[model samples]
Target: MKATVDPGRCQGHARCWDISPEVFDLDEEGHGTVLVAEVPAEHEEAALRAAQNCPERAITVA
Candidate 1:
């Protein structure tokens, strides 16, 4: 699976980082960054949760 974050929509809620810090990263300004564009088999669940948890709905997973 692949994940994308829309910078324009992100409000730096850090929900993704809270769900999976290894998969998501936060910049100094508190914006979220997708550390891995593609989710590994083991991390699929976490990635999905992170995306779902995004209050701004900035994360998209496919």
Candidate 2:
């Protein structure tokens, strides 16, 4: 799966990073940023978990 973050919807909750630091990067403001355009197979689970953990639903996985 591939994941992306909607910057407009993200707050500074940091739950995405807390759940999957390897797949999501936090900006200086602590909002999540997608680490890659597409998630690698090995990291898909973590990416999905991060997406689900986002309270703002700022993360999308496909």
Tell me, by lDDT, which candidate is best. 1
Candidate 1 lDDT by residue in tens digits, 1-62: 88888999999999999998878899899999989867888888998999988999999989
TM-score per candidate, chains pooled: 0.92, 0.89
lDDT of 2 by residue, 1-62 (tens): 78889999999798888888778898988878988877889888988888888888999999
Worst 10 residues of 1 by lDDT: 34-43
- Which 10 residues in a row give candidate 2 its minimum summed lDDT? 30-39
